[model samples]
Target: MPAHIGRPVIRLAAHRVTTDALLDHIAATCRDADDPTKPHPRLGLWKRLIRNTGVEQRYWTRPLQEATAPSSVGHRAGVAFGDALDLAESAARDALDVAGLDPGDVDAIVTSHTTSWTVPGMDVHLIERLGLRPTVTRIGLSTLACVGGAQSLVHALWHTLARPGARVLVVVAETLSTIYHESETTPQSMMYRALFGDSAGAAVVTGLTDETSADLPTGFVALDPLELVMPNSRDRYWGTIDDEGLHFDSTRKAAAAATDAVPYITDWLGKRRPEWAIVHPGGPRIIDDVVTSIGLAEKAGRYSHASLAENGNLGGTAVLDVLARTHDDPPAPGSPGALIAFGPGFTAAGVYGAWI
Candidate 1:
C-alpha cells in the first residue's frame, strides 16, 4: 500500500536553453524549398504545425550546421556533434550547480536524447569534462523515446539498490527542431511535431540510509518503477532521416493499441490506488487513451493536460516535467502518485512513487 521506493532524492533540478528561443528559430528558418509558385521554401508546410504541436517552445544547439561545428544544412542535417555537446554540457553543469553537489559526488551519469549521438555519448563526455570519479557509471538511452526518463530511473534505482550512498545524475537533452525535414508533409511527419520539442532536464538521484523515496532530502521527488515489457505484433513507433530532415512514424494501429493496454494499467492502478497520476504528457491522444482506458480521466488527466499545454512532448523530459509541476512546496512525505509513460517499441512503463 505504501508507494515509497527507489534510492530517493532529487538533490537538484536544472534546465538550459529557453524553449521559446528554439521555437522562434525553428519558425524563422523553416523554409519550404519545394513551394512551386512561391519559389520559397519557408512556405511549404501543409499546415502551421508550430502552433498546433502545442509546444510552448523548445531548445536547439544553434543551427545544427551553423553553430560551432560546421554543417551543410542542404546536404547534411543539424549542427555538428560538437555543437550539441556544448549545449548538453552546459545544461548538465547547471544541474550540478543547483544540486550543490560536485561532479566528484556523482557515482553515475545518465543521459537521454533523440536528435543526435556522440562518439563517446554525453555520459562519458560529461564525466571527463566534469572530472567525475573514474569509476562512475554511465547509462545512455536513445531508443526509449518519451519513456527515457522512467527507463533511466529504473536503471538508477537498481544501481542504488545494489550500493548505498552513491549518487546518480540524469541529463535529458532534446533538440527536436534540428531534425526537421523541409521536404516532407506525410501524416507521420505532421503528427511527430505534435509530440516533440527541444529541451533539457537534469537531476540527481541516489542511494541513502532510507529505503523509500519519501525519505529523500529536500527538493527530491520520487516514483516507483512499473516495468512493462509490452511487445506488440509490429513496430508501433519509429523514426527516420531523409531529405526532409527527420520523420517519425506512429501508426494508427499504435493509437488502437492503446485499447489493449487499458486492462493491464487498470489492474495495475487498482492495486495501488494512486493519489496523483504523473502520466507522460505524450500528446493529446496518448494521454486521452491511457486515462480513458484506466478510468483516471479526472485525476491524472489534470497533470497530463497541464504538461501538454505548457511544454509539448519533451521526449525523455516529459515525465520529469510532470513531476516538477506536481511537486508540493512543504512537500508531503509519502503521498502516493503514479508515473506512467509509453514510447517506441510499443513499450509501456509505469512507476508508483510517493512524495517526500
Candidate 2:
C-alpha cells in the first residue's frame, strides 16, 4: 500500500516517582517483619537489578503509599482505569492540538493499553470524555504488551489508507505501577517493579499524497510499517491473571529471542536503514542487542537509552515517549527514521518514517 499515513504527533503524560525513592520504599516494605535475622532474600538482587535498569526515575498513577500498599486486584483495576482515562484524555487533547485538529475532526480512534482491563475498554471512555463523535470508529487493543503503541499507529495507518482523508487518533496509555505490590518478591517481579512506570501517549495519523500535501503536518511521516510474530514463541514472554493480580513471566532468554529475530527484521527492511531509530527501551540488554543485531550505529540508540534512563519503561507508551523526544529535537529534515517495539508473542513491530 502507498504511504498514506501522515506525520504522527505524540504527547506523553507521566506520574512522579524517582528511582531512588522507589528503591528505598521497596527495601523498607520488603524487610522481614517476623524474622530480623533473615533479610528479604531478594534484597541484594533487587538493588543490583534497579541499578542495572538504566532508569533514574519513573511515574506512577497512585501515590507511593497507595501503590506500595497491599491491594486486591479489583481495587487496583479500578484505580488504574480511572487514572488511565484521565491521562488518555490529556494526551489525546494535546496531540490534537499539536496536529491542529479537534476531537470532532477525528474519524477513528485506536486505543492501546496493557496495564488495565475494562469491559467497555478505554476507547469508549475516551470518546465520552473527549467529546469525540459517538459514531467514530474505535479499535481497542488491550493485549500486545509493549508493542501496543507502535501497533496502534500501524493500525491507524491502515485505517487512513482504507479511507482517504480520514484522521485517526492513536492513544496508548499504561499505568503499570498500579499493579506493583510489595508482597511479590520474585526476581522477575522485582525487575519489573524497578523498570516499569505509568505513562500515556497519543498520536494523530492521517493520509498524505506528497510532501506538500495539505494533510502533512510538522511531524514524522510513517512509512513501511511491519510486524513479525516469532513462531512457537508465545511462551517466551507472557502474562497471567491470578487471584492476587497480573503476573508477568519472561525467561532469561527474552533478550536473546529479540536479538535472534533481528536478522529476519533486517531482511524484511531490505536495504532501508533508518538514520534515526526509536526503539522500545525494553532494557539495557535488549537495546544493546538490537543495535548490534541490526547493525545500527550506537548513536542511533541514544533516544531509546535516554527514554529508559529518564522514564524507565512506560510499557505500551515507551516507544511513543521516544518518538516524542525525537519530535522535540528531530533528525535532519527528510532523514529516514525507524520505530520499533517488542512485546508478548515475542513480537516485533516496526515502521520506517521520514522527518517532515
Candidate 3:
C-alpha cells in the first residue's frame, strides 16, 4: 500500500463567465420564451441561489451565450467531447512533466469523465495524444460525478500497490457546461448552470520502490486504511439524457445525506483527526455541512472553498483542483490530512494521509 502521488496539474476552460452574466442570460432566455412584461416567478429564487453559490465566476469551453444556447443533443455531445479531450490532453502532459516523467514512463493511464459519451473514451485519445506506450494499461470510469477525482487516485494507488515500481497517470476532466439546456428552466437546471464549470485535473502516482524515493514533491505518500462509503442513496442526485438534452436532478436532501453520514465516517476514522480536511466543494452548503459534521477547524476547508469561489464546481475534477492548491501550500510536515469527495452515488470517498 505504499505509493506517492505527484502534484496535480489543472487545466481550465478558455472562457471565464461571471454569475451575473449567467443570470442575465437566463432571464432573457426565459422572458423571450414566455411573457416579456411579467418576471418569471422563479427568477428571484434563481438569482438568490446563484449569488449564494459563493462562486463569483466559472470557466467554460465557450462563452455563456454559446454554451447555454439552444442546441441539438447530438451537436452538444460532439462539442463537449472535443473540449474534454483538449483539456485532458493539456492537463495530462503537465502532470507528467511535474512528475519528472515522460508519457512513456507511465505504466498505466486512469481517467474519469461523465459529461460526454464516446466509444474508446478519453483514455484512448490521451494514450495517443501523450505518446504513452502502446502496452500502457487504460481504465476509464464514468458516472461517479464529483467523487470521481478522489476515486481515480484510489484506483491509481491500488495499481501501484499491485504492480511494484509502477507509475500511473490519473486524469479527471468534465465539460459540464455542454450539458446545459436552455429549454429546461427548472431550479435544478438553473443551479447547474450557475454552479457547474468546465475543467480538467491530472496527477501521477508512483509506487514506492524503497524508502529513499520518499522525497516526492508535495508530500503525497499514500496513507493506509483508505475508505470509500456509499450509502445507497443514489436518488439524491443524478442526470438523465433525452432527446432534448441532459437534465440533472439534485435535491436539497443531498446536503442532509452528507451530514447524516458523518458519524459513520468519524467511526471509521476512530481516534485520528487530520490536521488538514480536504473536502469537496460540492457547493457552499455541502462544504459547511461536512466541516460542521466532522468538527474540522474553521479554516481547515479553505482550499475547497477557494476552489469553489474561484472555479465553481468542476464536477468530477473539483476535488483535484483543491488538491493541487493544497499541494502548492501543503500542511506542515508529518501533519495528517484527509481527502473527501461526494458525488451522484450519494457516496463519500475518503483517504487519510500524512505530509512528508
Candidate 4:
C-alpha cells in the first residue's frame, strides 16, 4: 500500500534570535577579562564562520543571555527535555488538527529527539499527554540529528504499509540551545551555535485510501525510502559529552559529506530529475550541492534556503519545515519530487514522492 503524508506543522521555541544578536552574545560571553592580551583567540574566526552559515535568524528554547551561561549537563538535560516536550506537543496537536484526525485515530507514533537524553522519551510522554490509545505502537529516535524528520516519516510509512489503513503520527523535536554552553570553544562547536535552532515538527501518515475515503488531504504519496551511510565517515560528525552538556562535533571533512552522497542519491533517483525537490536545510552548501547535482533549477531549493535563513537548521525539523513550505506553494498536481536530510553518521535519508 502507498503511504500518504498530510501537511506538516512546525512549532518554534519562545525566543527569536537574530544573527547579530547571536554574534554579540558570543563576544560578550567568550571574552578574556583576566588575560586581556589573548582576548579569546578564536573570536574573529568564529565570527567569520558564523556569518557564512546563511542563517539570518533562529529560535531557542531559552533566552540568549541565559543559554550561553555555564551550566551542568544534568541541569541542561532537564531543561532541554522539558522544552522539547512542550514544542513537540504543540506541533503534534496542530498536525493532527490539520489532518482532521483525533488523537484516538493514530495507530502508531514515531518520534525523534537528540538534544536530550531521557529514559521515557517523547514517544511515551506524547502517548499519554496526547490521549492516544495505550496500545499504540511507538518508535523513538534519539541520535539521528538532522536526519530525524525524514527518517521518522520513513518509519511511519513502513508502519502504514504494514498495517494497511493505520494512521501514524510522526514528530521530531530538538532543543539545540541546550548545547550552547560557553565551554564549547572549538570552531565546529561555535558553528553549531549559529547554525541550529529549537523547533518541533509533526505530520500524519497513513495508507492511501480508496476514492470513497479520499477526503483526506494528502500533500504527497510516498515512494520507498532510501538510506545510505558513507564509508569511514563516522568521524565526520558525531556527538560528545562533558561536564557542561552534550555537544555536536565535526571534522573539516564534514563540508563534503553532502556532496559525497550525491552520486548515490542520484543513482537511487534513477538518474532523472525530480519535478520538485525538498532538500534539508543543513546549510547553504548542503542545499546547493544537492540541488545542483540533481539537475534541479536554483529556484527548486528556495524553500530549503528560506528555512535556513528564517529558523537556522532546526536540526531534525529542518526537512519538515522545508516540506511545509512546499505545501504552502505547491507544485503542479501529480508532480514528482524528492525529500532528503543528512545527519551525524554522515548518513542520508530520502523519500521520493508525487504531489497529490
Candidate 5:
C-alpha cells in the first residue's frame, strides 16, 4: 500500500530580521567597531556573498543582536535545542491535529536535527513532551542538514510500507542561528551565516487503510523515493566545531553541487515531467538549476523562492516549509509531482509522487 503524506505545518522562531538589519548586525559584531569609518578587510566579500543568498528576511531563535554573541558551546547547545524543541512540539501537535490523529496514534517518529548536539537528542524529548508511546519506533538523523525533510519522509514511507497501516510522524527542526557566531569568518561560513534561519516543520505519513483511506487529507501519495550521494563530493560542504560553536564549511565547488547531481536525479525520474516540484529553498542558484535541468516550468520553483525570501534557509526544515506552500497553491488532483532536497555530504534525497 502507498503511504499518503499530509500537508506540512511550519513554525518559525519569534525574531524577524530583515536583510538590512542582518547586515547591520554583522557589521557591528563581526567587523572592528572601534573605528566606524573603517570596514573589516573582508567586509566587502561578506556583503557580496550574503547579497547573493536570495534571503530578504529570516527569523532567528533570539534577537539578531544577541544571536552571534560569544558563548560557550554548552550554553549555545542548551538555548538552541530548547528553542527548537518548542517550535517542533508546536509544529508536531498541529500536524497531528490536521490529520485527525492523537499523539498515541503515532506508531513511529522520524526526526532530523543538526543545529545543536545533545545526548538522547530531540526524539526522546519529543516522545515525552508530545506523549507518544514509549515503545514507538523512532529514527533520529543528526547530520543530514538541508536534506532532512525529504529524507525523513523517505523513512516514513519505508516504515508504512513495512508495517502496513502504521502512521509515522516526520519532524525536522533546526536552530541554525545558533551557529551564526563571529568566530566563523571564512567566506563559506559568512555565506552560511546569512543564508540560514531557524524553524521547525512536521508532517504525517500513513499507509492507506479501509478506515483511514476515507479520511486521508488531500496531499501527495508517496511513490518512489531516491537517495543519492555524488561520488568524490564530500568536501563540497561539511560541518566543523570550535571553542565558540558549530560552523558550516564549504569549498568553491559547493556552489555547483546541486547542478552536478541533476543527471543522476533525471535518470532516477526517467522521462516523467513533474507537474509540480518541491525544490528545497537552499539558495536561488540551486533552485534555478534543478528546475531548469529537470524540465519543470519556471513557476515550479516559485514556492521555493518565496520560502527563501520570507524565511531564509531553514536548514533541515526548509523542504517542509516549501511543501507547506505547495499545499496552499495546490495542483490538479492526481497530477504527478516531485520533491527534492540537497544537503551536506553532497547528498540529495527525493520523492516522486502525485497529488491526491
Candidate 6:
C-alpha cells in the first residue's frame, strides 16, 4: 500500500469488438417478440418482453449460437478460450504500439476479465507473444466482473515501483458475448442475457522518476489506491454450467448485499474527495442506490452513464474504458482524476490521481 500519489504515464492502449457480427445477432435472434411494445401474444409472456434499454447497439466476438465449445467439450462457452485470447493479443499489440515500446521492455503484466477462462490465462500467452523479459511477473484475477481493469492497473503500478525503470502492462479482455444460460426461465438468466456484451481493452502503465517525469506528459494522476476485502464469505456473483445451460449467477442480491457496505465506503472515501469519484456503472439502480447512501450525489454518476452507452457491462474492463473517455482530451502532465470499482464478495478498489 504505497501512500497513493502522482500521475501514471499511460504509454499505450486499445480496445476491440466484433461490431457488425454482434448487431446481426441482436437483430436476427433476439426477436421482436422480446420487445414489450410489439409483444407476440403467442410467443408467450417472457419471450415478447422487449429490453429497449437504449443499448440498441453492442459488440460481440461472434453470434451467440456460433460461440460454442468443441464436440468433446459439448455446448457453447459463449466465447472459447483461444478466441478470447486472440482478441486480447490484438488489443495488447495495439496498446504496445501506442506506447512506442516493444514487448521486451515490459517488466510486469496484469490481466483482467471474468467472463471467460484461459488455462494458463491471458498473461502467460501474452508474455510469450511479446517476448517479455524472462523475469516478468504476472497477476491473473477472476470474479471482479467489470471493475477488474483498474484493479489490475493498481497491481501493475505497485510492481513497477518496487523495481525502478519498470513498465507494467494491464490487459483486460471480456467476451461477455459468452456468459450464457441456456435456460431463460429465471430472473438471473434473463438479466444477464440482455445485459452482457463482448469487448477487449489494454494499456501500459510506465513508471516516471523525477528525471523521467520532466520529459513525459502528465496523465491521470493517482490518488490513494485502496482495496477492501469482505470478511464474510459469500458467493453472490459467479458463472456456472447446469441443466439450464451456461448460466450466470448475477444473483438478485448482488446490489442489495453491496449496499450493506456503504458506511465503510463513505468513511473510506472521506480520506480524500468523494466529489471526484469514478464509480463503476454496475447498472442504473445499482449506481443510484450506492451513490445515494455514500453521499456522492453529484460525482459518482459520470462513468456509469458512459459505460452503459459505449460498451454495456464490460465485466472486468469497464473502469479503464471509461477513464480513457472521461479524462481531459489533451490532459496536462498534472491533471487529477479518481478511479474506483466494485465486484463480487462486495469488495471495492479505489485510486485518485493527477495528470502527469
Q: Rank the candidates by lDDT, best first.
A: 5, 4, 3, 2, 1, 6
All candidates' lDDT scores? 0.60, 0.80, 0.83, 0.90, 0.91, 0.59
- Candidates in order, TM-scores: namely 0.77, 0.93, 0.95, 0.97, 0.97, 0.78
Cα displacement (angstroms), candidate 6, residue 41, comes to: 8.2
lDDT of candidate 1 over 246-282, digit per residue (tens): 5577676776665566676777766766555667877
Candidate number with the higher TM-score (5 or 6)? 5
Q: Tens digits of per-residue lDDT for model 5 on 143-178? A: 898999999999999898899889999999999998
Write the residue-wise lDDT of candidate 6 on 327-346 in tens digits.
54434444444566777766
Best by lDDT: 5
Better of 1 and 2 by TM-score: 2
- Residue 36, candidate 1: C-alpha displacement in angstroms: 3.8
lDDT of 4 by residue, 23-60 (tens): 88788778776786455777899999999999999999
How much lDDT does candidate 5 score?
Answer: 0.91
Q: 86 in model 2: Cα distance from truth in Å?
A: 0.6
Model 2 alpha-carbon miss at residue 182, Å: 1.6
The CA root-mean-square deviation of candidate 1, after full C-alpha superposition on the true structure, stands at 5.2
The alpha-carbon deviation from the true structure for residue 325 of candidate 5, after best TM-score superposition, in angstroms, is: 0.3
Clashing pairs in 3: none
| Model 5 alpha-carbon miss at residue 139, Å | 1.2
- C-alpha-based local distance difference test score of model 6: 0.59
The predicted structure with the larger TM-score, 2 or 6, is: 2
- Quote the positional error of residue 235 for candidate 6 in Å: 5.2
Instruction: Tell me how candidate 2 scores on lDDT.
Output: 0.80
Give the alpha carbon lDDT tens digit for every residue of 1-356 in model 3: 67777788999999999887888887877763366776677888889877888898999999887887888788888888899999999999999888889888899999999887788888899999999999999888887878888888888888887898899999989999976887777777778778888999999988888753755666567775344556677778888998856767878776577776787778877898877777889888788777766767668888889999899999889988988898889889888777788878677777677777
